[model samples]
Target: MSVKEQVCSLSIGIVLFPNVTQLDFTGTYEVFARLPNAQLYLLAQTLEPIRSDGGLTFLPDTTFTQAPALDVLFVPGGPGINGKMEDEKFLEFLKIQGKQARYVTAVCTGSLLLAAAGLLQGYRATTHWLSLDLLEMLGVETVAERVVIDRNRITGSGVTAGIDFGLALAAELFGDAIAQAIQLGIEYNPQPPFNSGSPQTAPAPVLARVTAASQNVQEIRRQIVQRVVTQLQTTNKLNHIYFA
Candidate 1:
């Protein structure tokens, strides 16, 4: 069997948290769900329903403890990532899974969570444009791109880029033909009415308005990243002392 055929039985786990951006997870979910014989898990701390920042609700089907070994470990980002950044249990879970998972992936602010877990420290990653600074503060090499792939780590930038990330990752795992078929099936052609997707392409007033609105949240994220960085540093020191 080819690599594509081998991956047909691959297990994929998507970490879901409260206030997660629905599109960040669902866009990639739609594509991964179409994978032939792939087992996908909506993983969470519990089996409870998770509410998105946009007010949509998703019921997680698997708890972290119940999750099996994953071939792909995916984390999605949203306002919830601030909470996750300092979540020791969640970070430990990622640390354990990430060490063994074949592919460690994230979208939007989710990459920040991966960084907190020490998964992306030396990797070049990207997140929502608004959170790129926070990602960098976590000691990750920040890339301003739609999608960035560094070895086994694949990360995507903000909301809509999840689709692009999904397609690219699918092509990497399966084959170009499979990814093309999936894209066509989803009718993934995008022709936006406005070209204001990026800060560079957006109107000056529009950029100012969004950036202004995001200032407070950005500060909060910065503080969280600081604490996480200190904690990671402390832990590394202790680990080195013990191992030495």
Candidate 2:
């Protein structure tokens, strides 16, 4: 590698909490792992094997307490983040690291945790379509797109959007030539058989059923988001007073 490239090595850390959606991490992991100067770390609360929502288990390379300063802090969303959003220490860790990282990123509902940690205030962001309202509730200007980038905060719309998020970040890091190479390596051209990826195109009946089925989960998310929002507001007020 040339001297210019030699200095490009970056510390990239992805959260690996239990019940995380593996694809949310793995899809991007595959891209970053192959990048010219990316050093990837799987971070979790423990070093034990973390089971993903799909039942796949992966071991963490480092615990949150042991994680190094990261160039990029990536959070992947799943049912798991529901509890982590309420974890004060975890939130504090994210808040500190996110502020320091060059890029604060998330795929799917991971944006919720970032917002809960008070990182998304005044930023235009996106998340899993179902959770966009939850993001708005937390004071974020939600964008309904595959990927939204506002300053250093980048977010993906939903699960499959992780791949796009990864490529976008790849381009940002190594330039279009390198990103194209990575995309070619992964055969990243996507042409789905179904056109129903979003509610706008999905059949009315199908969308209704899916919405109905997820009502309970949505309610739980709303309740939890309300709590987190309150906490964030209180913390911001305290910080204001302290700084004043």
Candidate 3:
């Protein structure tokens, strides 16, 4: 096959879980789906209508068993990541697909799930700003950036960063010309009414309220993170011993 045919025929799989933040995946989908001959797969445990945190529902195209080997594997996060951390089967599935994927990526807290799957081990990654420290505790060198591409493991910070991640992935997969054309088609110009996107830009009262609201989630994630890290460490030790 020619270079163009190879690029066009590649597969892109996006993992769908219960309560995933739709924009985290969709934003990237909007970009990647624009790639020439891109075959996007929505994968889940089953071919059901998976719901998002914001009440949106999406029908998955395939299940774990039916999923094909993907050139790109994407994971998106929301409140769902907390629950998925304990799902051994799903983590195993991720590990299997991720190891074979040309590019393994996540947006928002999705990276935490990747970490739990042992895919982000020793990689520099990023996630939602509020959860950066939590991700760091998972044995990843977490970076604070809109998008981080450490080798083939690309990660994006927060929800909106998914667009940037997609474009970057597209550029890597195809070329800057294709990525730029997609960006132009989407008209992804950002102009927020308020300058409160990040903690540094938000006012004290606004930041305090936001932090307070997420305190419960933070606490719960902290608990899960500790367990996940411990389990991964144990698994690593056992694997080392067995291999030795």
Candidate that scores best on lDDT: 1
* TM-score of model 3 vs. true structure: 0.96
RMSD of 1: 1.2
**Per-candidate RMSD, Å:** 1.2, 2.3, 1.7
The total of clashing pairs for model 2 equals 0
Cα lDDT, all candidates:
0.93, 0.90, 0.92
Better of 1 and 3 by lDDT: 1
Best candidate (score: TM-score): 1
Which is the winner by lDDT between candidate 2 and candidate 3? 3
After the best TM-score superposition of candidate 1, give how far the Cα of residue 133 lies from its true spot, in angstroms. Answer: 1.1
Tens-place lDDT per residue, model 3, 134-180, is 89998899899999999899999999999999999888877788888
Question: Which scores higher on lDDT, 1 or 2?
Answer: 1
Predicted structure 2: lDDT: 0.90
- The segments of candidate 1 whose C-alpha lies over 4 angstroms from its true place after superposition are none
User: Can you give the lDDT of residue 214 in candidate 1?
Assistant: 93
lDDT of 1: 0.93
How would you encode candidate 2's per-residue C-alpha lDDT over 6-104 as one tens digit per residue? 446799999878889988988999888888867999998889999999999999999999999998999999999899999998898898899899899
